[model samples]
Target: MANGLTVKQQRFVDFYIETGNATGAARKAGYKKPNPQGSENLAKPSIKAAIDARLKEIEDARVADAREVMIFLTSALRGELKEEVVVVEGEGEGVSSARTLQKQIGAHDRLDAAKQLAKRYGLDGDGELLKLQKEKLKAEVNEMKTAPSDALHINFTFDRRPKDGH
Candidate 1:
Protein backbone atom coordinates (compact mmCIF):
# COMPACT_ATOMS: atom_id res chain seq x y z
CA MET A 1 0.00 0.00 0.00
CA ALA A 2 2.87 2.32 0.85
CA ASN A 3 5.23 3.26 -1.98
CA GLY A 4 3.67 0.53 -4.13
CA LEU A 5 4.66 -2.13 -1.57
CA THR A 6 2.21 -4.85 -0.57
CA VAL A 7 0.56 -4.70 2.83
CA LYS A 8 3.03 -7.23 4.23
CA GLN A 9 5.96 -5.42 2.70
CA GLN A 10 4.81 -2.13 4.21
CA ARG A 11 4.41 -3.83 7.58
CA PHE A 12 7.94 -5.18 7.25
CA VAL A 13 9.26 -1.66 6.59
CA ASP A 14 7.35 -0.24 9.53
CA PHE A 15 8.63 -2.94 11.84
CA TYR A 16 12.11 -2.43 10.47
CA ILE A 17 11.88 1.27 11.27
CA GLU A 18 10.73 0.53 14.80
CA THR A 19 13.06 -2.36 15.61
CA GLY A 20 16.07 -1.64 13.31
CA ASN A 21 16.48 -5.40 12.86
CA ALA A 22 15.53 -6.78 9.49
CA THR A 23 14.95 -10.46 10.45
CA GLY A 24 13.15 -9.40 13.60
CA ALA A 25 11.02 -6.98 11.62
CA ALA A 26 10.22 -9.72 9.11
CA ARG A 27 9.20 -12.04 11.95
CA LYS A 28 7.06 -9.34 13.49
CA ALA A 29 5.49 -8.77 10.10
CA GLY A 30 4.49 -12.51 10.05
CA TYR A 31 7.02 -13.86 7.61
CA LYS A 32 7.53 -17.62 7.85
CA LYS A 33 11.10 -17.49 6.52
CA PRO A 34 12.12 -14.21 8.12
CA ASN A 35 15.88 -14.30 7.50
CA PRO A 36 15.69 -14.83 3.75
CA GLN A 37 12.56 -12.73 3.39
CA GLY A 38 14.13 -9.86 5.24
CA SER A 39 17.22 -9.98 2.99
CA GLU A 40 15.03 -10.37 -0.09
CA ASN A 41 12.91 -7.37 0.91
CA LEU A 42 15.98 -5.27 1.54
CA ALA A 43 17.22 -6.14 -1.93
CA LYS A 44 14.08 -4.66 -3.54
CA PRO A 45 14.67 -1.24 -5.08
CA SER A 46 11.16 0.02 -4.34
CA ILE A 47 11.34 -1.11 -0.72
CA LYS A 48 14.79 0.44 -0.27
CA ALA A 49 13.52 3.68 -1.77
CA ALA A 50 10.53 3.66 0.52
CA ILE A 51 12.74 3.01 3.52
CA ASP A 52 15.09 5.80 2.45
CA ALA A 53 12.24 8.26 2.00
CA ARG A 54 10.68 7.34 5.32
CA LEU A 55 14.01 7.52 7.11
CA LYS A 56 14.67 10.96 5.67
CA GLU A 57 11.23 12.07 6.73
CA ILE A 58 11.75 10.72 10.21
CA GLU A 59 15.15 12.38 10.55
CA ASP A 60 13.86 15.71 9.24
CA ALA A 61 11.02 15.54 11.72
CA ARG A 62 12.97 14.50 14.80
CA VAL A 63 16.72 15.06 14.57
CA ALA A 64 18.25 18.41 15.54
CA ASP A 65 20.53 19.85 12.87
CA ALA A 66 23.38 22.30 13.25
CA ARG A 67 21.18 25.37 13.34
CA GLU A 68 18.89 23.88 15.96
CA VAL A 69 21.84 22.77 18.08
CA MET A 70 23.42 26.21 17.84
CA ILE A 71 20.17 27.86 18.80
CA PHE A 72 19.82 25.58 21.80
CA LEU A 73 23.41 26.23 22.92
CA THR A 74 22.95 29.97 22.56
CA SER A 75 19.69 29.93 24.45
CA ALA A 76 21.23 27.88 27.21
CA LEU A 77 24.19 30.27 27.43
CA ARG A 78 21.86 33.25 27.63
CA GLY A 79 19.80 31.67 30.40
CA GLU A 80 16.64 31.81 28.31
CA LEU A 81 15.81 28.15 28.87
CA LYS A 82 14.09 26.99 32.05
CA GLU A 83 12.93 23.73 33.58
CA GLU A 84 10.57 22.51 36.26
CA VAL A 85 11.83 20.17 38.95
CA VAL A 86 9.63 18.28 41.32
CA VAL A 87 10.82 18.61 44.90
CA VAL A 88 9.68 15.93 47.30
CA GLU A 89 9.23 16.93 50.93
CA GLY A 90 10.31 14.29 53.40
CA GLU A 91 12.57 14.61 56.41
CA GLY A 92 13.40 11.53 58.49
CA GLU A 93 9.82 10.31 58.71
CA GLY A 94 7.92 9.01 55.72
CA VAL A 95 6.78 11.26 52.84
CA SER A 96 4.59 14.34 52.53
CA SER A 97 3.86 16.24 49.34
CA ALA A 98 5.70 17.02 46.13
CA ARG A 99 6.03 20.53 44.78
CA THR A 100 6.87 21.52 41.23
CA LEU A 101 9.30 24.44 41.22
CA GLN A 102 10.26 26.49 38.16
CA LYS A 103 13.89 27.53 38.04
CA GLN A 104 16.66 28.51 35.65
CA ILE A 105 18.74 25.71 34.22
CA GLY A 106 21.58 24.34 36.30
CA ALA A 107 24.86 26.26 36.50
CA HIS A 108 27.02 23.37 35.26
CA ASP A 109 24.68 22.88 32.32
CA ARG A 110 24.86 26.56 31.39
CA LEU A 111 28.62 26.53 31.75
CA ASP A 112 28.85 23.51 29.47
CA ALA A 113 26.71 25.28 26.93
CA ALA A 114 28.91 28.34 27.16
CA LYS A 115 31.97 26.17 26.67
CA GLN A 116 30.44 24.59 23.60
CA LEU A 117 29.56 28.01 22.19
CA ALA A 118 33.07 29.23 22.85
CA LYS A 119 34.51 26.21 21.09
CA ARG A 120 32.31 26.84 18.06
CA TYR A 121 33.69 30.38 17.68
CA GLY A 122 37.27 29.33 18.58
CA LEU A 123 37.18 31.41 21.75
CA ASP A 124 38.21 28.51 24.00
CA GLY A 125 41.93 29.19 23.39
CA ASP A 126 41.67 32.77 24.71
CA GLY A 127 41.46 31.58 28.29
CA GLU A 128 44.51 29.37 27.96
CA LEU A 129 46.56 32.08 26.21
CA LEU A 130 45.53 34.64 28.85
CA LYS A 131 46.53 32.29 31.67
CA LEU A 132 49.93 31.63 30.05
CA GLN A 133 50.54 35.35 29.55
CA LYS A 134 49.67 36.08 33.16
CA GLU A 135 52.08 33.40 34.36
CA LYS A 136 54.90 34.74 32.15
CA LEU A 137 54.34 38.29 33.41
CA LYS A 138 54.41 37.12 37.01
CA ALA A 139 57.66 35.28 36.42
CA GLU A 140 59.20 38.39 34.88
CA VAL A 141 58.13 40.50 37.84
CA ASN A 142 59.68 38.01 40.27
CA GLU A 143 62.92 38.02 38.28
CA MET A 144 63.00 41.81 38.30
CA LYS A 145 62.61 41.84 42.08
CA THR A 146 65.57 39.49 42.64
CA ALA A 147 67.85 40.87 39.89
CA PRO A 148 70.96 42.99 40.77
CA SER A 149 70.86 46.67 39.77
CA ASP A 150 72.56 47.63 36.50
CA ALA A 151 73.65 50.98 38.07
CA LEU A 152 75.79 49.20 40.72
CA HIS A 153 78.80 48.37 38.48
CA ILE A 154 81.89 46.72 40.03
CA ASN A 155 85.38 47.21 38.52
CA PHE A 156 88.54 45.38 39.76
CA THR A 157 92.09 46.88 39.56
CA PHE A 158 94.95 44.71 40.79
CA ASP A 159 97.49 47.61 40.93
CA ARG A 160 98.89 47.89 44.48
CA ARG A 161 101.86 50.29 43.75
CA PRO A 162 101.27 54.07 44.27
CA LYS A 163 101.41 56.43 41.27
CA ASP A 164 104.55 58.01 42.85
CA GLY A 165 107.19 55.44 43.68
CA HIS A 166 106.54 54.10 47.21
Candidate 2:
Protein backbone atom coordinates (compact mmCIF):
# COMPACT_ATOMS: atom_id res chain seq x y z
CA MET A 1 0.00 0.00 0.00
CA ALA A 2 2.84 2.31 0.80
CA ASN A 3 4.97 3.74 -2.06
CA GLY A 4 2.76 2.08 -4.68
CA LEU A 5 3.98 -1.37 -3.56
CA THR A 6 1.55 -4.31 -3.46
CA VAL A 7 0.77 -6.07 -0.19
CA LYS A 8 3.37 -8.76 -0.90
CA GLN A 9 5.92 -6.19 -1.98
CA GLN A 10 5.29 -4.18 1.20
CA ARG A 11 5.70 -7.36 3.22
CA PHE A 12 8.91 -8.03 1.38
CA VAL A 13 10.15 -4.56 2.31
CA ASP A 14 9.26 -5.12 5.95
CA PHE A 15 10.98 -8.50 6.01
CA TYR A 16 14.04 -7.14 4.24
CA ILE A 17 14.31 -4.30 6.73
CA GLU A 18 13.92 -6.60 9.72
CA THR A 19 16.18 -9.42 8.49
CA GLY A 20 18.62 -7.44 6.30
CA ASN A 21 18.84 -10.36 3.91
CA ALA A 22 17.06 -10.24 0.57
CA THR A 23 16.87 -13.98 -0.13
CA GLY A 24 15.67 -14.74 3.38
CA ALA A 25 13.15 -11.95 3.23
CA ALA A 26 11.79 -13.36 0.00
CA ARG A 27 11.49 -16.80 1.52
CA LYS A 28 9.81 -15.45 4.62
CA ALA A 29 7.40 -13.36 2.56
CA GLY A 30 5.72 -16.56 1.28
CA TYR A 31 7.92 -17.58 -1.62
CA LYS A 32 7.41 -21.35 -1.37
CA LYS A 33 9.64 -22.59 -4.21
CA PRO A 34 13.29 -21.83 -4.80
CA ASN A 35 13.60 -18.18 -5.70
CA PRO A 36 16.97 -17.82 -7.28
CA GLN A 37 15.54 -14.55 -8.55
CA GLY A 38 14.78 -13.24 -5.07
CA SER A 39 17.60 -10.71 -5.18
CA GLU A 40 16.38 -9.70 -8.61
CA ASN A 41 12.95 -9.00 -7.16
CA LEU A 42 14.50 -6.72 -4.58
CA ALA A 43 16.35 -4.97 -7.39
CA LYS A 44 13.10 -3.73 -8.93
CA PRO A 45 13.09 0.06 -9.02
CA SER A 46 9.92 0.45 -6.97
CA ILE A 47 11.01 -2.07 -4.36
CA LYS A 48 14.48 -0.60 -4.21
CA ALA A 49 13.07 2.87 -3.67
CA ALA A 50 10.78 1.62 -0.92
CA ILE A 51 13.64 -0.15 0.81
CA ASP A 52 15.86 2.93 0.56
CA ALA A 53 13.16 5.13 2.01
CA ARG A 54 12.60 2.73 4.90
CA LEU A 55 16.29 2.57 5.61
CA LYS A 56 16.56 6.36 5.57
CA GLU A 57 13.69 6.60 8.02
CA ILE A 58 15.35 4.09 10.34
CA GLU A 59 18.69 5.91 10.15
CA ASP A 60 17.03 9.26 10.88
CA ALA A 61 15.23 7.89 13.92
CA ARG A 62 18.43 6.57 15.49
CA VAL A 63 20.49 9.70 15.66
CA ALA A 64 24.12 9.33 16.70
CA ASP A 65 26.04 12.18 15.15
CA ALA A 66 29.78 12.24 14.60
CA ARG A 67 30.11 14.60 17.57
CA GLU A 68 28.43 12.06 19.81
CA VAL A 69 30.73 9.29 18.57
CA MET A 70 33.78 11.50 19.16
CA ILE A 71 32.60 12.38 22.67
CA PHE A 72 32.12 8.70 23.50
CA LEU A 73 35.59 7.84 22.20
CA THR A 74 37.07 10.71 24.22
CA SER A 75 35.31 9.51 27.35
CA ALA A 76 36.56 5.97 26.77
CA LEU A 77 40.13 7.22 26.25
CA ARG A 78 39.89 9.22 29.49
CA GLY A 79 38.74 6.10 31.39
CA GLU A 80 35.55 7.85 32.42
CA LEU A 81 33.41 4.82 31.61
CA LYS A 82 33.20 2.18 34.32
CA GLU A 83 34.80 -1.17 33.50
CA GLU A 84 32.64 -4.28 33.93
CA VAL A 85 33.60 -6.64 36.71
CA VAL A 86 32.80 -10.24 37.66
CA VAL A 87 33.03 -11.91 41.07
CA VAL A 88 33.27 -15.62 41.83
CA GLU A 89 32.73 -17.13 45.28
CA GLY A 90 34.75 -20.14 46.39
CA GLU A 91 32.90 -23.19 47.81
CA GLY A 92 35.39 -24.29 50.54
CA GLU A 93 36.13 -22.56 53.86
CA GLY A 94 39.89 -22.63 53.25
CA VAL A 95 39.48 -21.11 49.80
CA SER A 96 40.91 -17.65 49.16
CA SER A 97 38.72 -14.57 49.30
CA ALA A 98 36.20 -14.23 46.51
CA ARG A 99 37.92 -13.28 43.27
CA THR A 100 36.99 -10.12 41.40
CA LEU A 101 38.08 -9.24 37.90
CA GLN A 102 37.41 -6.21 35.72
CA LYS A 103 36.80 -6.55 32.00
CA GLN A 104 39.45 -4.97 29.79
CA ILE A 105 38.99 -3.01 26.55
CA GLY A 106 42.44 -3.05 25.09
CA ALA A 107 44.47 0.14 24.62
CA HIS A 108 44.83 -0.67 20.92
CA ASP A 109 41.06 -0.56 20.46
CA ARG A 110 40.76 2.82 22.12
CA LEU A 111 43.68 4.19 20.13
CA ASP A 112 42.20 2.90 16.88
CA ALA A 113 38.82 4.46 17.68
CA ALA A 114 40.51 7.75 18.46
CA LYS A 115 42.44 7.58 15.21
CA GLN A 116 39.21 6.95 13.24
CA LEU A 117 37.55 9.96 14.88
CA ALA A 118 40.58 12.11 14.15
CA LYS A 119 40.48 11.04 10.48
CA ARG A 120 36.75 11.73 10.23
CA TYR A 121 37.22 15.28 11.51
CA GLY A 122 40.03 15.95 9.01
CA LEU A 123 42.40 16.63 11.91
CA ASP A 124 45.09 14.54 10.29
CA GLY A 125 45.18 16.41 6.95
CA ASP A 126 43.17 17.98 4.12
CA GLY A 127 42.01 14.68 2.66
CA GLU A 128 40.68 11.55 4.33
CA LEU A 129 42.84 9.41 6.63
CA LEU A 130 43.92 7.05 3.85
CA LYS A 131 45.02 9.95 1.69
CA LEU A 132 47.00 11.41 4.56
CA GLN A 133 48.63 8.06 5.13
CA LYS A 134 49.52 7.84 1.47
CA GLU A 135 51.05 11.30 1.60
CA LYS A 136 53.10 10.41 4.66
CA LEU A 137 54.31 7.23 2.97
CA LYS A 138 55.28 9.21 -0.13
CA ALA A 139 57.24 11.65 1.95
CA GLU A 140 59.11 8.83 3.66
CA VAL A 141 59.87 7.30 0.26
CA ASN A 142 61.19 10.62 -1.02
CA GLU A 143 63.35 11.01 2.06
CA MET A 144 64.79 7.59 1.53
CA LYS A 145 65.47 8.39 -2.13
CA THR A 146 67.40 11.57 -1.23
CA ALA A 147 69.42 10.10 1.61
CA PRO A 148 73.18 9.49 1.22
CA SER A 149 73.96 6.46 -0.91
CA ASP A 150 76.70 5.45 1.51
CA ALA A 151 74.07 4.68 4.13
CA LEU A 152 72.64 2.03 1.78
CA HIS A 153 76.00 0.35 1.26
CA ILE A 154 76.89 -2.51 3.60
CA ASN A 155 80.14 -4.53 3.36
CA PHE A 156 80.51 -7.89 5.14
CA THR A 157 82.62 -11.02 4.68
CA PHE A 158 82.47 -14.50 6.10
CA ASP A 159 85.70 -16.22 7.18
CA ARG A 160 85.87 -20.00 6.71
CA ARG A 161 88.29 -22.08 8.77
CA PRO A 162 90.18 -25.05 7.28
CA LYS A 163 88.72 -28.45 8.12
CA ASP A 164 90.39 -30.13 11.16
CA GLY A 165 91.26 -33.26 9.09
CA HIS A 166 92.82 -31.21 6.32
Candidate 3:
Protein backbone atom coordinates (compact mmCIF):
# COMPACT_ATOMS: atom_id res chain seq x y z
CA MET A 1 0.00 0.00 0.00
CA ALA A 2 1.51 3.28 -1.07
CA ASN A 3 1.13 6.58 0.84
CA GLY A 4 -0.34 4.84 3.89
CA LEU A 5 -3.37 3.72 1.87
CA THR A 6 -5.15 0.45 2.62
CA VAL A 7 -4.64 -2.42 0.20
CA LYS A 8 -7.92 -1.69 -1.53
CA GLN A 9 -7.37 2.06 -1.41
CA GLN A 10 -3.86 1.47 -2.78
CA ARG A 11 -5.25 -0.35 -5.74
CA PHE A 12 -7.77 2.39 -6.30
CA VAL A 13 -5.07 5.01 -5.93
CA ASP A 14 -2.80 3.32 -8.42
CA PHE A 15 -5.58 3.06 -10.92
CA TYR A 16 -6.60 6.65 -10.22
CA ILE A 17 -3.03 7.92 -10.63
CA GLU A 18 -2.96 6.13 -13.97
CA THR A 19 -6.43 6.91 -15.34
CA GLY A 20 -7.49 9.83 -13.13
CA ASN A 21 -10.95 8.34 -12.59
CA ALA A 22 -12.41 7.14 -9.28
CA THR A 23 -15.43 5.12 -10.45
CA GLY A 24 -13.47 3.47 -13.22
CA ALA A 25 -10.51 2.74 -11.01
CA ALA A 26 -12.71 1.39 -8.24
CA ARG A 27 -14.42 -0.93 -10.71
CA LYS A 28 -11.07 -2.10 -12.01
CA ALA A 29 -9.80 -2.61 -8.47
CA GLY A 30 -12.16 -5.58 -8.02
CA TYR A 31 -15.52 -4.03 -7.24
CA LYS A 32 -17.11 -6.71 -9.44
CA LYS A 33 -18.70 -9.16 -7.03
CA PRO A 34 -21.82 -10.17 -8.99
CA ASN A 35 -25.02 -10.95 -7.07
CA PRO A 36 -27.75 -13.52 -7.92
CA GLN A 37 -29.42 -10.77 -9.93
CA GLY A 38 -26.34 -10.83 -12.21
CA SER A 39 -25.34 -7.27 -11.32
CA GLU A 40 -22.09 -6.15 -9.72
CA ASN A 41 -22.33 -5.24 -6.03
CA LEU A 42 -20.36 -2.02 -6.34
CA ALA A 43 -22.54 0.10 -4.10
CA LYS A 44 -20.13 0.50 -1.20
CA PRO A 45 -20.14 4.06 0.16
CA SER A 46 -16.58 3.83 1.50
CA ILE A 47 -15.30 2.97 -1.96
CA LYS A 48 -17.24 5.87 -3.40
CA ALA A 49 -15.81 8.24 -0.81
CA ALA A 50 -12.26 7.14 -1.55
CA ILE A 51 -12.84 7.64 -5.25
CA ASP A 52 -14.31 11.11 -4.64
CA ALA A 53 -11.29 12.14 -2.58
CA ARG A 54 -8.89 10.82 -5.20
CA LEU A 55 -10.75 12.72 -7.92
CA LYS A 56 -10.55 15.89 -5.85
CA GLU A 57 -6.80 15.42 -5.46
CA ILE A 58 -6.43 14.95 -9.18
CA GLU A 59 -8.41 18.11 -9.88
CA ASP A 60 -6.37 20.11 -7.39
CA ALA A 61 -3.17 18.85 -9.00
CA ARG A 62 -4.41 19.99 -12.41
CA VAL A 63 -5.20 23.44 -11.02
CA ALA A 64 -1.73 23.72 -9.47
CA ASP A 65 -0.15 22.72 -12.79
CA ALA A 66 -2.06 25.45 -14.62
CA ARG A 67 -1.08 28.01 -11.98
CA GLU A 68 2.56 27.08 -12.45
CA VAL A 69 2.24 27.55 -16.19
CA MET A 70 0.65 30.93 -15.68
CA ILE A 71 3.52 31.97 -13.43
CA PHE A 72 6.10 30.81 -15.94
CA LEU A 73 4.50 32.61 -18.86
CA THR A 74 4.04 35.77 -16.85
CA SER A 75 7.69 35.65 -15.82
CA ALA A 76 8.81 35.20 -19.41
CA LEU A 77 6.74 38.16 -20.55
CA ARG A 78 8.05 40.35 -17.72
CA GLY A 79 11.59 39.45 -18.75
CA GLU A 80 10.83 40.52 -22.30
CA LEU A 81 9.33 43.73 -21.00
CA LYS A 82 12.59 44.41 -19.16
CA GLU A 83 12.96 47.98 -17.95
CA GLU A 84 9.82 49.06 -19.68
CA VAL A 85 7.38 47.39 -17.25
CA VAL A 86 6.79 50.39 -15.04
CA VAL A 87 4.26 50.03 -12.28
CA VAL A 88 2.66 53.43 -12.08
CA GLU A 89 0.41 52.48 -9.17
CA GLY A 90 0.62 48.91 -7.83
CA GLU A 91 2.48 45.65 -8.08
CA GLY A 92 1.66 43.22 -10.86
CA GLU A 93 0.68 39.61 -10.16
CA GLY A 94 3.93 38.05 -11.37
CA VAL A 95 6.14 41.07 -11.71
CA SER A 96 8.83 39.97 -9.27
CA SER A 97 9.91 36.80 -11.07
CA ALA A 98 13.65 36.44 -11.74
CA ARG A 99 13.48 35.16 -15.31
CA THR A 100 11.52 38.27 -16.30
CA LEU A 101 12.83 41.49 -14.78
CA GLN A 102 10.87 44.71 -15.05
CA LYS A 103 11.87 48.39 -15.06
CA GLN A 104 10.67 51.62 -13.52
CA ILE A 105 8.28 49.81 -11.19
CA GLY A 106 6.17 52.08 -8.91
CA ALA A 107 2.70 52.56 -7.53
CA HIS A 108 0.29 55.45 -6.92
CA ASP A 109 -1.74 57.20 -9.60
CA ARG A 110 -2.56 54.37 -11.98
CA LEU A 111 -3.71 52.07 -9.20
CA ASP A 112 -5.95 54.76 -7.80
CA ALA A 113 -7.48 55.37 -11.21
CA ALA A 114 -8.24 51.70 -11.69
CA LYS A 115 -9.76 51.44 -8.23
CA GLN A 116 -11.91 54.43 -8.82
CA LEU A 117 -13.24 53.19 -12.13
CA ALA A 118 -13.91 49.75 -10.77
CA LYS A 119 -15.65 51.19 -7.75
CA ARG A 120 -17.81 53.41 -9.92
CA TYR A 121 -18.96 50.38 -11.89
CA GLY A 122 -19.42 48.19 -8.76
CA LEU A 123 -16.74 45.78 -10.05
CA ASP A 124 -19.00 43.09 -11.42
CA GLY A 125 -17.54 41.97 -14.76
CA ASP A 126 -16.05 38.49 -14.99
CA GLY A 127 -12.75 39.59 -16.59
CA GLU A 128 -13.02 43.32 -16.36
CA LEU A 129 -9.62 43.75 -14.80
CA LEU A 130 -7.98 41.79 -17.60
CA LYS A 131 -9.74 43.81 -20.25
CA LEU A 132 -8.77 47.02 -18.55
CA GLN A 133 -5.15 45.90 -18.36
CA LYS A 134 -5.10 45.14 -22.07
CA GLU A 135 -6.54 48.55 -22.89
CA LYS A 136 -4.02 50.23 -20.62
CA LEU A 137 -1.17 48.35 -22.26
CA LYS A 138 -2.34 49.39 -25.68
CA ALA A 139 -2.62 52.99 -24.58
CA GLU A 140 0.84 52.87 -23.01
CA VAL A 141 2.34 51.53 -26.21
CA ASN A 142 0.63 54.15 -28.29
CA GLU A 143 1.71 56.95 -25.98
CA MET A 144 5.31 55.82 -26.29
CA LYS A 145 5.27 55.43 -30.07
CA THR A 146 8.46 57.42 -30.46
CA ALA A 147 10.24 55.88 -27.45
CA PRO A 148 8.43 52.58 -27.22
CA SER A 149 11.16 51.02 -25.13
CA ASP A 150 11.37 53.89 -22.70
CA ALA A 151 8.51 52.89 -20.41
CA LEU A 152 5.01 51.40 -20.14
CA HIS A 153 2.11 52.04 -17.81
CA ILE A 154 -0.74 49.75 -16.85
CA ASN A 155 -4.16 50.29 -15.34
CA PHE A 156 -6.97 47.96 -14.35
CA THR A 157 -10.73 48.45 -14.23
CA PHE A 158 -13.78 46.44 -13.34
CA ASP A 159 -17.45 46.72 -14.25
CA ARG A 160 -20.66 45.74 -12.48
CA ARG A 161 -23.51 43.83 -14.00
CA PRO A 162 -26.38 45.92 -15.26
CA LYS A 163 -29.46 46.07 -13.05
CA ASP A 164 -31.79 44.74 -15.75
CA GLY A 165 -29.28 42.13 -16.97
CA HIS A 166 -28.78 43.97 -20.22
Q: Judged by TM-score, which candidate is best?
A: 1
lDDT of 1 by residue, 63-122 (tens): 998899999999998889999999988866685888999899988999999999887775
> Which prediction has more favorable TM-score, 1 or 2?
1
TM-score of candidate 1 on Cα atoms, chains taken together: 0.52
Return the top candidate by lDDT.
Answer: 1
Q: Write the per-residue lDDT of candidate 2 for residues 31-140, one digit (tens) a residue.
A: 66426646876779999999999999999779887778888888776656556666767778867555657655568767776777777767765546678789999997
TM-score result, candidate 3: 0.31
lDDT of each: 0.89, 0.77, 0.55
lDDT score at residue 50, model 2, on the 0-100 scale: 90
Error of 3 at 150 (Å): 60
Q: In model 1, which regions exceed 4 Å deviation? A: 1-8, 19-39, 86-97, 126-166
Q: Could you tell which candidate, 1 or 3, scores higher by TM-score? A: 1
- Please give the TM-score that candidate 2 achieves against the real structure: 0.42
TM-score list, all predictions: 0.52, 0.42, 0.31
Give per-residue CA lDDT, model 3, range 72-100, as digits (tens): 44444344323444334434874453343
How well does model 2 score by local distance difference test? Answer: 0.77
